[model samples]
Target chain A: MNTITHYSDEIINAFVDGELAAAERRELLAAAAESDRLRQRICEAVQLKELVRGAYPARSPEGLVKGRSGRRGARMRHAAAAAVAVLAVSVALLLPRPEPGQRLADGALSPVLPLSTGEEAGETTRVVFHVSSADPAAARELLDQVELVLREYAAGNRPLKVEVIANNEGLRLLQQGRSPVAERIRRLDQRYQNLLFAACGNTLERLRRETGEQIRILPQAVIVQSGVSFVARRQQEGWAYIKV
Target chain B: MKTMRPYTPFLLLLSLLLAAPLAFAGSDDGPKHKIVIQVSSDDARTQKIALNNAVNLQKALGQDNVAIEIVAYGPGLSLLTSKSRQGKRVESLAMQDITFSACGNTMKKVARKTGKEPQLLEGVRVVQAGVLRIMELQEQGYAYVRP
Candidate 1:
């Protein structure tokens, strides 16, 4: 039976959040199958869930999982945790493991890039800034915009998370001693849990090989496998992507 | 600028049917996902990549399964203008239901600079403020990307 009419947006969002019971999930899926409107709503809910998850990157949903055996909230939390677990497992399994030579980001980290955890716990405004231009003026402008955006969020009392993914010529902005805005970056790093600086490993390796110079990244930046892939993953995960 | 050639839906469905595990529905079932892309650069290379990103996304998601709006502001507004090197591509994508938005604020700035408003390519919508439009789209649950 189509119980589509019974499912409200709240219920749908809860479902997307993995807060639904097995029977409820089945019911919702069945309903969604028949109604394009329901399917669309589910997709939107999925987007919101991913956005919220951006506030808690790589952090397991166990905090939301403990109590489903009794209270409804508990059950919802349990379901959410289970859903996230399944997703994580599937993601890990589905993603191909690259060879050692294939790694373009960090030689120091695990072969599989470990996504850093974000500590924020609230509705998050997520943006992934992609920087590929090497222009110092552009770098300066990018930092200016980054600072302006963070301040705007603070001014509005909204929690924001920004990931600056750099590669190619833009990687210079994160290079130690070579960066034009090193001091500003250091200061920004001190000021916000809001900003994440992701340096591309591939670019570093290439630069090292081509130039034979040690390319040290600023202390505040983390080297991801590839800046481009990091941005792609962020976009796929529902982060608003901005090219700077 | 180019006009749309009539599409044969049956052939498309037949092709999709061959690729089925339903990565996308076999017919024009409307978009399940909405994306808002920003292009704020005047660099021809960057502008070209933005359009390419939009087109690639459509190809991957199935043209009818993802709604895309490419919003250009500041120097990026040049991509939607008559003078754009990619003007023909913009018009072609416009026919694919991918929206092209030019910032009205940028239009005024161009007018003040050149003593005339920048003319837009066909089917491009002008929004009052590009940044604000992007914020609005994000609020409305559209995934935002800039390539």
Candidate 2:
């Protein structure tokens, strides 16, 4: 599942750095097409590379940001997903099994050091929560844990950067019309930008297609590429990862 | 599917050190991506999802750009069986350079129960243990996905 979901941060950073070959770049793009997480990793990679290059604020690439609007993301979304699925099944060829422990990312495999956080804006501890289950109990459990974490950080007088990324079945937690816990989410969202609620774009597209509903998200919920990628990025940046 | 830690105070249990973020694992050569998929269910739907994930990965990343592996165990051992519904697809995928690993432990169990070793499809590889294959792949930086 990691292969289908996770891409090492190195590959993404390298791609964003334009240090990868065309063949590898296309593969990454194609893989990111069907994966919500891979796309998010790509987004993080782009942001980090740009930040390093002092080129932030440039427009994000297209397709990577689909499903921003309700009407805009409908119908066509399914076709695109179907096409990608079909493409996924159709491609085939022969290759040798890679030796175990041999990474496929960069040849150097050097660890890219993170920028010093002491100089970061605040005494903040970033925590990214991954919510993928559709079960109501699971959603409630996540919120409960989140509240506790929020309180703990509050006690420490340390700012916390928290992102609750909802994807797959767990997306129900953030849906304006579908979430069973809308009130709680609103209360938390209103707390401040520190606690973010992100709706997975791919999950939204799927929901829109399956139900033929605009399926509005909570007002404060931000749209992200995918939950797995969001969590992966946060983990890469040394943020805490919580699977709820 | 049951709770692993229903009431475990996740934060208290894992008071993470926010000192330094993890170091990157980027290499400049070979296939740029490696993924290992786990198929541990006997359900037809789940088995197909796992296969689709593998083939889609192959298509998206191209055969040469990514190394793919599918490891089966427990009930999922059905996936690598010669008589399995996915036999044709598995054989075709194996020829495409995708590695399909059957659990030797499961094979021994099945053989003990049925009094004969189950035949795996052509090109499939048998590992000493299925879960261990996944663990090793993960340790090697192969992305792990359980579908």
Backbone clashes per model, in order? 6, 18
**Candidate with best lDDT:** 1
lDDT of 1 by residue, A103-187 (tens): 3234343211211222222256677778987888789767766776777778888767777888999999989888999999989
- Chain A alone, TM-score for each of the models? 0.54, 0.51
Error of 1 at B42 (Å): 2.4
Q: Largest DockQ belongs to which candidate?
A: 1
**Candidate 1, after superposition: displacement of residue A114 in Å?**
22
Tens-digit lDDT track of model 2 for A1-244: 2232223444565566565567666656755665554575467556544443342122222222221221121124478765654443333112233321232132332222221112232234666678888877668757765776676667777656667888998888888777889999888866643576777777888889998987777766656545666677555555555555
lDDT of 2 by residue, B1-147 (tens): 666666566655554433223222234455889888878668899999999999899999899999999989877899999778899999999999899999897799799999999999999989976754664575455776878
| TM-score to true structure, per model | 0.50, 0.36
Error of 2 at A168 (Å): 0.5
Residue pairs in clash, model 1 = A67-A74, A68-A74, A68-A75, A104-A201, A104-A202, A105-A201
